[model samples]
Target chain A: MKLKIKDVEFKNPVLTASGTFGYGNELEDIIPVNELGGIVTKGISLKPRMGNPPPRLAETPCGLLNSIGLENIGLEKFVKEKWPEIKKIGPEIVVNIFGEKIEEYVEIAKTLEKEGIRCIELNLSCPNVEKGGLEFGRSERVVRNLVEKVRENFNGVIFVKLSPNFTDIVKISKAAEKGGADVLTLINTIMGMSIDAENMSFKIPRKVAGLSGPAIRPIALYIVYRVYQEVDIPIAGVGGINDIKSALEFHLAGSTLIQIGTALFIDPWIPFKIIKGIEEFLNKKNMEFKSIIGYLNKKRG
Target chain B: MRFLEEKSEIINLIDLGKDYYQIVISAPEISKLARPGQFVNIKVTGSLFPLLRRPFSIWSAKENYIEVLCKEVGIGTKILREKKFGKISLIGPLGKPFPEPSPEDIVVLLGGGTGIAPLSFYAERITENKKIFFAGFKHLPSPYLLRRLEEVCETLIIATEDGSMGFKGLLSELIEKEFKNIESEYTKYFVCGPYPMLKVFEKILPEQRTFVSLEGIMACGFGICMGCAVKKKGENRYLRTCTDGTLFSLKDIEI
Candidate 1:
């Protein structure tokens, strides 16, 4: 069960979504990291971010709202302190990078290039940031420019993580493909907020956060399907993917790789269980990776 | 360092009155590894409705059972209270343990409402140190908890805000009154409760000698989400409540 995106082959098709996996070192004792296909580190910025205020997380019906605001160790400290530890994990390590400006994004990617990172996921879709998060990602021109700058600077695989807050997801996908993005992470968390009605105050200090979990799976699947129909680039489906059934829906809708996000909070062992479950299903069906991926779209009668 | 994800069956669920409850579970492995400040994350239901797990400090662990003191404040705890004898997942003994105190030191355990849970457990573990338990409840606490604390603490002081119990004032005022009578030797205070109670301890006691267990909204009770962050004193960065500590010395954190 091998999966390839942009000439880089993955051992499997499961990965832990960024921000949800921490530094990939925390869960090493609970589950073997090397056994999975890959892991995306929590988003890193050019300069260290202190993140949002307290009460950053809240639970909704079948979902979670988080305003973490991309709190990271910054590029210098991450390379010096955290990168040494991150590279030791067995799976492919994709560094999820964010920025307040276009230059910062390029700077973070260029620094990662020097460290020989195989792939970098440009976080253009964090709902928590003020400048370059979902704001920069909503416009087609801005996405193309940002991706093109990083593509010119770094030679490794580049993934553009798209936000679902946009008007037309297919247009955003096309812009990323035209700007030389090797792959596209289909969706990020949906923008949302919660309130404590009794106190009449916002649950998160930032006033808004990203919504994730089983609540947003159907929406992610639809976006992946639309993006798959419009672009030829590989898709890494993320958001609300909890089990193998969720993962299979992404594959059937034309996703080559799937990342598990909020559900990891419930069970850290979910990724391994999903990998084994997928293997069993593939064995039972006498099918291969290519045969199942985009099968529904191909046979659309 | 030992942690278990056990489907613990509720052995007893008693309403301590005023929406507070004591849930006792038969979990031998978790009880064996349990220490003073460590907490457990309980999955309220099998459904994904209340998506994240709620964390509770280990109130007391005896023989083969561990207990948690919970107040029905939110949706998760409300659902938790309605179910009796239902099995749910429990992940523990998570977070750093309370530092061990020296034999000659006098340990003062000050608790407000459900915060009394872990302090009682800490009192049970210490036989060398002189224990003084000061508890403040909105009203009178359950007889079971009062008797249990009385059994372990050398001196038990009770207070209630509504003037229905021993001292008719806030817990801070009760501490002020009791301070004059007790000689200040090698004294250390372990305080847990609302933020205001912890603030009072920070003002009155030496930072090095005061230990406070924090309560925050945590998505992952281990260190993954970086959600439950507390500001470090005189620093720009934050410390994770789940991994860095549920119990921290007053000198290290701001409230």
Candidate 2:
């Protein structure tokens, strides 16, 4: 049931997505977080982000909308104040890095690489922000350039997280792979909006927000399956994956790894339970866990 | 962290008037760590919907037991009331606590409905200070909570809207009347209740010394979700109630 990406080996393929887990220290009082495969931290930037205005989040039918805007302390504060506590958890830590400019991304990536963080997830597609992420992610040239620039500076496993709003996900995946990206995390939150019809205004304080949770799972799985075919790099599937069944769906769709998001707000223990459930599923069916990778792609008649 | 599965036992359950219940749990670890004005997030046993834990302020904390006064307004508290003496899972000491009061200061605690829980612990902790508790209920005081308050405070003032209890007025009126004769120099106010009550208190009291505990529906009892954020007055940034404070100096917050 174990899966290896680069030099790091996970006990299971199930891990929490960045921005969802909140550095693994917040949930420590409630649940034993070490039982999960690993944790991806909230995106850390070169400068601290104050995030968006109030009413930053709202609940939809079976999903959530967030415009948190990647609110995080800067790299200096994170490494000095927060990293020591995060390191105490002992789970394989993957630092998710974001920046407004290519140099800023390389700088943060280089810093984390030197600090002994095994992996760097380049956040090319955070929908809530005004610039950077979506701008670079939607274009093939910019994505390729940024990925190569970061890859040149950082030696750690480089993961380029992709956006769901794009029409041509395959082109972006190919560009990332061409630039020497080690992994691809499919489908950051889909760009969406909710309006208060009575007031004739946006529902969120920020007019636009990112839609996540069970609502985006189908689209995410579609992107993962599509990208897996085009790119040889390992895929870390994410988006509305709440439970074991949902995670297994990504594995079948050609994702070698999976990230659980949105669902953490609903139930923090979901990732741990999903890890356990996958083992149970594999045992009952008498199948190797790795055998399911790309299993659905070939079976599609 | 050690998850003491056996420690979260419900020792007593009392039905207060107006669909409220006083639940006393024998959670020694939570009690030992909890400070006045802090809260606990509780998950009701065997409920599929409302899967998130509900945040409740610690009403009282003793050596081996802790108490929470919950108003049965939603599915979560209703399910919480049905549990027997041996079940429930809780996660807590989740939020920041009220700052300790000065020895010579006059502590005035105001609460309405279920918000009285955290203030009761504040009253219990400040034994050296002179304390006046103004409690408002729709009808008479819940017998269980009233008795618990009597054991902690120096003076207790009861007010009900319907004139079904002590004073025939609102709780804020009683607070005004109590503070009328005394000089404002020695007073420090701490309030947690309905937003309107807190809003009015924020206006009436001195800005520097008064602190109000703001309540909001929280999915994550932490800074991550940005659910329970209150805008800091005149500042661009909002502060998270779970991390920065559930208890904040009245001067810093914008109602």
Candidate 3:
């Protein structure tokens, strides 16, 4: 039920994905915040973001397309105005940071370090933004550079959230490892689009948006399985993780941690359900947590 | 107060005809939490195909039940129309409520099409004010809650674009004329409809005294997804429709 990446230890393997679990305060009344592994906050930037326009989300067949553009309280206000409220909830808060430029990411990281933040998730893979988000995540060189710069000033655990839009995810995973990432989260939402055939118009205002929910689970699992074989750093599997079965699939695919995204919208208390289900599954199998990780790739035959 | 996610069973699903329908569900917890101007996010099907919940403004809330006025506009709503009776998932009552009107104020509620849903609920809550309900329709809707709204309001007016049942013209035009004649000392306006009607009222009404309940395709009923972002008037930032408001001060928002 515990997971360790670099120096910090997670109480469980189940975490809430960034941009899905507000600032860990909205659902605190319903879901016990301190019980889960951790909670990654919605993506924050150096300055306050208003996000995209109306119609930022659209429902697709078995999925959701979103172009929220990472609306968040800027780093200054988050520390000054929001941090006290967030801290009171008592979870391992992983502040998810994004930037329009490399320097902006470093500035936010330095601010996080100053504020005594224990962990930070570098958002190199948000598809909603028009700036240097997904572009930095897919390119190996950019990923390495961004991570290296944040790693220089911030001593806390850094998780590099990567994009699934990449052609070779393993190469990107290696790039984060080479840049001294404590852990890597794979994968962010996959870029997809839907159209209104009768109107001949795109459903989302942004022609393409990140697709999440049950539709992207298989793709996330395949990427995690491939990257686990190639990288040494711990992997935080994300995308389409809703129930205990899907959580086990990630662990079997070699992920030490799993984060639930769009599913939180459906049920905010799902983390508790998933955590309890996992405990029962392990008990029935008469196995330990380690037995599940890398189990699929082990010498079974 | 926090919202609740409840398993509600369909108590009534009546076709109001012309593709419009009324869906009433038994959700005691949500009924207690619901206030006027707020909405509930309903999961149309208990399947994975339609991944997101459809948001509906509260039409009525009694002791242990809630009502939603719906029109079969798309695949999700179309599926919702077919369900006669069963259990479904609902998360609500989400968003801020309409501002309370003062005893001396004349509260004007303007609604178009299914937009009449929340205003009818609003009328039922205000007992100290002079309530006026203006409802507009494309054609004669089969059997809406006009009589119920009439009982709640001091006055009621119906307008139809095709001149089928009431005054012929855009509801906005009627609203403009009505506002000019009534010139009360303290007046508050609550309006909801298609975007175009909202935009028209934005120009006609005094921004400070008007509040508008807006709609957008939303994923989370809370603030997480930022799916319901509404542009702030004369400002660079956006306000979340689910958290900041489904009801926003007209002076603060663009439309």
Candidate 4:
């Protein structure tokens, strides 16, 4: 099950998505962290953010709407506290870095590089934050410029996590690749809103939030399939993956690696269950893991 | 810090009427370790209609069964109420427990509606401190819970808005009325209730002596989701209700 994206090696293709799995140490009481291919830390910025007020989460059908505002311990605390603990968890730790300014992104990258982090997932598509997240990715020029500067600062693997929100996703995918991304993590939460009928106020006080779960699976799949056809970099598929079938759907749609997100809330053991399911699936079909990736597009072509 | 996803059997589900139901499930390990004020996140059905698990304070736990009392307020609780048989997933014994009172101190347990759940568990477990419970509700509780609470506390006062039960006024009014005689530094108060009821207690109870249990809207009842944040008193940073507390001293929080 060994795989490589740039110089970083993965034991498997099942990683826990950022924000979904906190610090990778939260569920040690339930599941072993080493079983995962990697754990993506919550979005860390240059300064600590208190996040949004109460009523941050609202349930929508088979999905969830959240406006967490990217609350984190910031860079200094993450490296001093979280990094040491997460690094001890054994899986490849992919630090998800966020910045309000383009220069902030480069600066955080420089710190992680100095700290000897092997890979980083750039968070350019966090819908909950007021600035520097989705706003930075909303422009092709900004996405390209941001990633290019980050490339200069961090010498290790870089994954540009793109959003499924507004603007041209394919163009932005190309912009990330052109700017020297090692991998493209496809699809952050799509923007959504929920209204409490009786209360007559927004369920998530911000009036807008990011939606994840099986509800956004199709949207994520389309984005992955579309981007896989256009970009040369590997696609790390996420968004609403709850089961083995959905996991493989992303794999067939051209995701080289798949991330378990909102579904982990449903069951913490899901990622491990999926890892076992996929390995079993490949053996029963006698198919190579690489051959199955992008199988739909490959067959059609 | 240790909790597991247990497939607990539905020992029984009883409709207490008035849209409230009592569910008893078997989770021996979680039940034995569960303390007062600890809660569980229940995935009520196998289907996906109600996506996230609902958090319920342990109404009571004994032997192999953990029971929770809930109202059919929304989709998740309604699904839980409608469950006829079989097992539902439960992740439990979560959050910090209500602090135990010193033997010399007198314990005052205050609750409203389903907020009585954890306090019932608390009063049942106390063998040292003298326990007094003040419960208020819009309607009278099911006779089973009413009787159980009566037995657990040395003194129990019941109040309903419509005067259908014991006292004819609010529990706050009853407590304030009663405490005029017993108010002392030796009294340690623990409150569990809806936001409005908690707000009323926050005003009447001494902040330094009161501990309030808060049940905020939650996605994951564990710390992972970062969804259950309650603002800390006089601080810019927020505390995670899932890990930091389902219980906090009244002086330590905004509400």
Candidate 5:
């Protein structure tokens, strides 16, 4: 079950995706989060965000569309308040940082480095926000430049989370690797909107929100499959992973690690289920854990 | 802040007519700790189309079981309304409960649609108090639910928008009229209904004493999603309905 990327040895290759898990303290009583490889905190900005207005979430078939707008307590409060509780949890805590400005991202990274944080996941793919996020993710130059700037400020492992919205995902993945990212979190929620026919308006007031769940699983897996072959850095697959079968598909498609997002709303215990099932499958097949990752890539026609 | 995710067994699903139902489930742990105003998020027994769990107010909680007043409004309830027997996943007793009423003060409960759920739960708990439970509907709800509700309240008032049954007026009108007949100085109001109903009371009801439960477009039913947002009355910020409240004071929030 041990998966090591550089000096960081994760207990399992399973992590809770950013923005879904709060500050990793919301479900302490309900789920065995310590058993997870890492807990990704909500995206923290330089200042506290009140988030988007109400009617922020809507359910469409097997997925959810959210315009949460990356709501979080600012970096100052995160380190002063949330970090104390999150650090006590057994799994590695990855502080997911977001910023509207490149300078803000550099400042946050420098602050986290000084605070002795082990890892930080850069959220360049959030579709709900106006300034940073998807704008930064779409341009290959911006992705590489921002990662490089943060890499200089922070000595810990840096994970760059990218989106599959419009631009070439392969181009972006290669850019993150070239910019000194330790790992690449493949595919944030795809940008989407649903219309309420009765009201003759958009389901989400933001007009466009991030689409996540099983609906986007195939997209995420394909993105990971494509990006894995293009970059040398490990790919942390995210988007629509819910159960063991879905989790394993990512590994075969070439995800070194996978994050559970929208399904956390459906079932909190899914991570545990996937973690145990992966170990069982590995033992049954008599295969090394690492051998299964991208194993299907070679077989695909 | 703490809750249990119990695999509750479905004891029965009784149709109360007029699109209302009483779903009784076996959940000992949840039943033991649950109070009025708190809710449980339940996933339908054998379906997945309605991916998110539906949140229901605790209509009743007895020795080893709990009930929710289910109204067939969407795909989630349409499937849930027909589920007679099996196991379903339940996560509760969530959110803050209504502040406890002192025996000396009078309690008023105003409800309409499925908002009658938590008020019904509260009515049973505070049966010993001098309470007035006003159950409003566009037409009459089933006699079973009405009769059961009447038996629990010290004084029960049934109001309908249409003249099908009881006082032919909105519950807000009924409450306003009742205030003239009954003393208003010491009455503490607990209202749960649609926004139009709640907003009307925010004007007529005493802000300091009135507590209203607001519903949100929920996903997790817990605090993770940050989806269920309610604006604070005078502040430029938001509060999560799951964590901060599904229950709030009339004076503290804007609708």
Candidate 6:
């Protein structure tokens, strides 16, 4: 079954998250990316980011911690070199934009609008870096103001991705909705740190990092549920969702769509598998997925 | 891109001294397309940790099968070693292939430990040319691959630091000794090993005729992450080892 958000209509509801899918061309040799719902590219900024130093990643109990610091080649290089190949993948190419200032976001969004991107996932919640990520995301006023500024310049489906570290996610999501965001992507990585006890040192290059994968599923689902109750906009649920069961949890929690992130490191074919599984699950139960979007929340006592 | 659905089955597993093992997988589609010095990124079945694919150089490719030699160093290889027959997943013959040696060229192939995998593949392909192999290991003798090297090359020289195998010295020393014995000039040298060993070869060999395969911590294996970059010599730019090379001329890379 198809799902429509604003002007874009996805063939299904399974899409790859930003920074996990790597522009969609890297996995071409092994898997077919066109079979999935869509692909959200790695975060693009005004200038190229070299990212963090070596030891940028560490494996935790059941998840991964990354301080990648948004390593990308800037919007100019992306539009010139990466876009032509990405367009051929035959899925909606949603560009994830990150910026240090309000104007930077508006400028990038306006550029992307002219470039014909199907949607724009505003990255206001990345927790890996020292500046411009959680700093802007943590404040409800700043999040609303930035969303309003981008909405003023660009006319596209604005999906505001929210951070999980906030004390009240419902407040921040309400702020985004008031500022004219079309959809909300619940729960970016939670701020977490790991220490090397023997050497009394930080395990990663940056002492503190953002945690992802199965470890963040509980928190992600909680935020998705809370935001679902407060916001009227469609939600694109992400974080720690690796299988059809986890995906179904998001759908039942009132998320209109789902994005696969940390699971991409484990299995690039997971998004495709989850898409197939959802279809089969719907067929077997003889029910349409769209009818059950928020069915679990409705039965809650 | 054409996706080949050939399932690769484990044909044989042999421990080759220390923690290393030679795993031979039979995939006709991959073997038929695989060339020397190419690598395959393997996804270990049923592994929850180290949830990324591991890249291994193709040791040998024959009729309908290809072999990958790996050491149980981390969680990925540990799970791979425990896998029995009838397990199957994705197989890719990726990256650039090794350069072919000219008929008149005398090749000196140097390798250390598991790095000898691609060298053996190169030795097997250039059967008509004069080839000399210098292999190095830690303490124990690598009988599994040593025997295989002897069958393909004109001469095979072994070196161990603990005097456990052929020559009681390093492989670099053996290369120096062999260099003095050969009166005819060798056309090219192919070296693949640890960074330190590669650094040593980069210092001694002539830049114009030497090629080295570099090893870097790779994530996507297809030049996206920009993790496997080697600085170009005399320039500030870097080339991706996954796309530009796992093999590059010695002069092209800084170190």
Off by over 4 Å in 4: A126-134, A299-301
In model 5, the clashing pairs are none
Which regions in candidate 3 have their CA more than 4 angstroms from the true location? Answer: A126-134, A298-301
Residue A214 in model 2: lDDT: 82
lDDT of 3 by residue, B15-106 (tens): 88788989989999999989998899988778776887888999989999999999899887888888878878999999888878878899
Assign candidate 3 its CAPRI class.
Answer: medium
What TM-score should be assigned to candidate 3?
Answer: 0.95
True contacts kept of 3: 0.79
Name the candidate, 4 or 5, with the larger lDDT value. Answer: 4
Candidate maximizing DockQ? 4
When sorted by lDDT, best at the front, the candidate numbers are: 4, 1, 5, 3, 2, 6
lDDT score of residue A93 within candidate 3? 85
- Evaluate candidate 6 and give its CAPRI docking class based on DockQ: acceptable
> lDDT for every model?
0.87, 0.80, 0.86, 0.88, 0.87, 0.79
Better of 3 and 4 by lDDT: 4
Interface RMSD of each: 1.2, 3.8, 1.3, 0.9, 1.1, 3.9
Question: Which model, 2 or 4, shows the larger TM-score?
Answer: 4
Candidate 1 lDDT tens digits, B1-255 = 447688888899998888799899888989999998899999989878688888999988888999999999888899889987898888888898888899888999999988988899899888898889999988878898788789889899999999888999889888877775653758888988988888887887778888899998899888999899999999888999998988888999987
Candidate 3 lDDT tens digits, A231-268: 87788999888778999999999888899999888878
lDDT of 1 at A182: 90
- Model 3 residue A28 lDDT score: 72
lDDT of 1 by residue, A1-301 (tens): 7877666778998989999989888877877789989999999998899988788998888899999988888999999988898899788899999887888888998999999888999988743254434477888898899899999999988989988785688898899999999989978899899999999999998888999899989999999988888888889998799888999999999998899999888888889899999889999999987788888875222
Best-matching candidate per lDDT: 4
Error of 1 at A212 (Å): 1.2
Backbone-clash count (model 4): 1
